[model samples]
Target chain A: MEELLAEVVNVLVVIVEACGAAVIIIGAVWAFARFAWVGFRQRTTAAFVPVRLTLGRFLALGLEFQLASDVLRTAVAPSWEELGQLAAVAAIRTALNYFLSKEIAEERRQVAAEQDHHEVTSTDHRGSGV
Target chain B: MSAVAEVTRLAALGTGLAAVVAGALALVVTRRPLPALAVLLDLLLAAGLLRLAGDPDWQGIVTAAAIVALRHLIGVGLRAGGRAWTGPRPPAASAQEKSAL
Candidate 1:
């Protein structure tokens, strides 16, 4: 009876593990799709197109890698190596977030500079008007 | 049932209630859903981790912590992510801003 109960528990664990792996895959894919859509939307603005696209691509890659690590964790991990990989994946996500925000800040700064220059030029032209 | 079990159940119930109240208050107080959801997610993460840590495997603990981090990230991310809150803000003139006065 004890052996049978142990087998049942193991089976249940495996099932849950599979479910967890599937969840990570779905979540990562969803995140990547959202990132791509956001990138496409930003492209319409024609501002910071290159920086934004690069950042979005990096974020999507990070999400995919993180998802892969998450799936591997549930599949074969009850080990230090797998846990370390998961940790690294988490770190990469954090780094990706950091760079994306940096990109946004740079974009904002560029916009502000352009606006200021426009204002200055317009003011100078108006002042020089005969 | 058993006293410990009863108390645990009650604590769980209380946490649930607090979570709901916080969520409602968040909308009224901040008028935003994402931050409120993040707060609720964090609370749930804490409650689950506290309850499940004893029997947890390695993968479970890391996954749980990562989930909590994501919730926290959502809060900061949305703050920096710039939601579609752009609109005609209050004009510079206080006289213009004063609608009731």
Candidate 2:
């Protein structure tokens, strides 16, 4: 029974890790395409902001999957060495994930502020013109 | 090494290459080095994270850590430099002044 359980876990770990890799690949390809299109069409520094935000979102998602796999690895039986390695990897990933999410929030706030400013300025212009 | 690890490494390499291309394109089109640099750093971080998908050894862990550190350093530097590029004339202005020059 123990061997059977370990086998199932090993298979699950592989599947989860593959899913995480796939997410990263898809995200990278999508972001690259958007980057090229936006850079070509808009050609402004501000325009690339959305693309960066999207990429960050994808990366954060992928990291979550990877972190899950890390946890699953230690579920069956974790030696001291394995646990130590897991701790290191998990810490690094957690830190990256936190920073990415924070940056995304900040970027969203900035974009919103800019849009609000634009709307107010346009309103003021129209009001003064009359 | 397992097949999954091999595939993940290859994917990471491809992602890194895509990052370089995207970064160069942004640099060329936007004509702003700072934004381009930020894009490059961000994509490289993605690549680094992707590399950690499989069973990463100590070396792989260290490499990813280094990338995270570098990204943080560069990100702080860019933020300090200001949110936007400060020095150069806007591209539109440069284009208009091209005839005068």
Judging by TM-score against the true structure, name the best candidate: 2
In Å, candidate 2's interface RMSD is: 1.0
lDDT for A30 in candidate 1 is 41
What tens digits encode model 2's per-residue C-alpha lDDT throughout A44-119? Answer: 9898999899888988898888888888888875588778778889999899889889889988997898899899
- Name the weakest run of 10 consecutive residues (lDDT summed) in model 2 chain B: B80-89
Clashes of 1: 0
Q: Report the C-alpha lDDT of model 1 over A1-130, residue by residue, as the tens digit.
A: 8566656654554444334333333333343343344334542233323333443343344344434434444544457865675565446445544654664566567567768989999999999994
The chain B TM-scores of all candidates, as shown, are 0.46, 0.78
Clashing pairs in 1: none
Fnat per predicted structure, each in turn:
0.00, 0.79
lDDT of 1: 0.46
The C-alpha stretches of model 1 lying farther than 4 A from their native spots are A1-77, B1-101
Report model 1's chain A TM-score: 0.45
TM-score of chain B of 2: 0.78
What TM-score would each prediction reach against the true structure? Answer: 0.30, 0.88
